[model samples]
Target chain A: MPNLYQEVIFWALFAITVFSALLVVGQRDMFRSALALIVTFLAIAGIFAQMNAEFLAVAQVLIYVGAVSVLVIFAVMFTKDMPHSTRSTNLQPVSIVVVGLLFIALSWAIFQSQWNEMPAELPVFVESTLVDSSSQLGTAIIRDYVMAFETVGVLLLAAVVGALALVRDK
Target chain B: MLERYLLLSVILFCIGLYGALSRRNIIAVLICTELMLNGVNVALVAFSRYSTPAFMRLTSVDASDSVKVLDGQAFAIFVVVVAAAEVALGLALVIALIRSRNTTDVTEINLMGN
Candidate 1:
């Protein structure tokens, strides 16, 4: 079981994540909403750290908070002059109902399911050096998941070329 | 503890859904989609920390006596990679839209209509 401090931190990060996500959705100013999105990503990274996924937490920071948020902010800046409002559309009522129903059904299923939970902490090794999760992840990617890894790289290259093609001068 | 995390994921997903469905700004819709993806990552990591598959439980073999599958974390990484690509293309598309339509309002840019 997680200690009291961990529990407190978890809840705090959770609250921050939810609040920032709401701001991202509700804020009228697009740039400020983008800023709030950075906060949400940061909080999610913190959550990942709490879950013992230190490698993923770092990746989340580097990729999401760093690259993705910057891209979004730039996009917002580029389109700053575009006439747009953040107000809800005519389907707002229907969307709210659908979202609410989705929440209820998902929560119910989560509660009803029986999960085979692992022990809270894995047994520590008696060896000289403790295994590093990041190193393990690197090995896993380059070894077992090499094919998928290369595919993602190719996909990223394709996306870059596609984006340039779409936006370049005609 | 796991349930709490899953609940948070559900809440985030729902909020994103509502925003994506109702908001007028195309950028906001993309941001909502990112929020939804983040929610999924939370659930994936939570499950990773909390559970191991039945096959890898007590019969694991290693120095640490743990099965280091890390499947959930791997999948989450892929999700992030795909999301980055998606956001890049999406932003590029947004830029293209702005260049052509001079607008970011999704409702106003109806190029295909009867």
Candidate 2:
């Protein structure tokens, strides 16, 4: 029961995500690249919504777009001429070869793996009671992944403390 | 549908890898890593959506059927949180490097004298 409207929207978001990712990598201007990355984050968040991940969509927007990208930009400001960041670097040729080979190898392995099949009853999850938002997710977090969740929070706190300690005037 | 999402994920991942490897700017590399993390995240969430038995049996009235519903999504959230922590620390390191070395270029940050 997929409609043309949904397909169009999906493709549009897909294009935005891919295009902005390319921009994030290829653009020399750091601020421009950060903006492109924000676009990519927003597009991916839209894709999450398209896939019926309402909670994740919101989290993606809040964390990636709102928090991470802004942090990147602020960090960019700490360096002068960082916006215009000239010089592509000497590693690019080696990087191209490495990344291309990795892509080929990964694609081959994935294609070889027979786990590409979706469930027979394929959940489009439009009206399912399991809208599966933050409530269920919170339950799962505090239940199944409780340790990981708490560890991550602790890790974030440590990172904050370590950063302050590291950047202090000596 | 799953294939398409995974394909997109692979492409996104490779692009991030390229960026991380090719960019001399430490900030660019950090951003690229975020891109790569997002790529993994898409795959996880897509699996949670389309491949999980919970989603398949979503309409079942059994109470336990909802337990592992979006484990992938939960894992993705964890990844996102960790990535944020990583970026914070990484950027701090970059700032510290700039303060010490007076440059943002990765090639120039040589601590060990050769």
Tell me, by lDDT, which candidate is best: 1
Q: Residue-wise lDDT of candidate 2 within A31-135, one digit each (tens)?
A: 899999999999999988887778889999999999998889998887855433467678889889998998898888767767635555544442352465668
lDDT of candidate model 2 versus the reference: 0.83
TM match of model 1 to true structure: 0.93
Fnat, model 2, is 0.64
Question: For candidate 1, lDDT tens digit of each residue in B1-114?
Answer: 788889999989998998999999999999999999989988987886676544454555564323245667778999999999999999999989888878888888776863
User: How many clashes in candidate 1?
Assistant: 0
Name the best candidate (by TM-score).
Answer: 1
Write one digit per residue (lDDT tens) for candidate 1, span A55-163.
8999999999999999999988888777676577899999989998899999999999887776556544311111465666676677778999999999999999999
Best by DockQ: 1
DockQ of each: 0.68, 0.58
The deviation in Å at residue A10 for candidate 2 is: 1.3
* Docking quality (DockQ) of candidate 2: 0.58
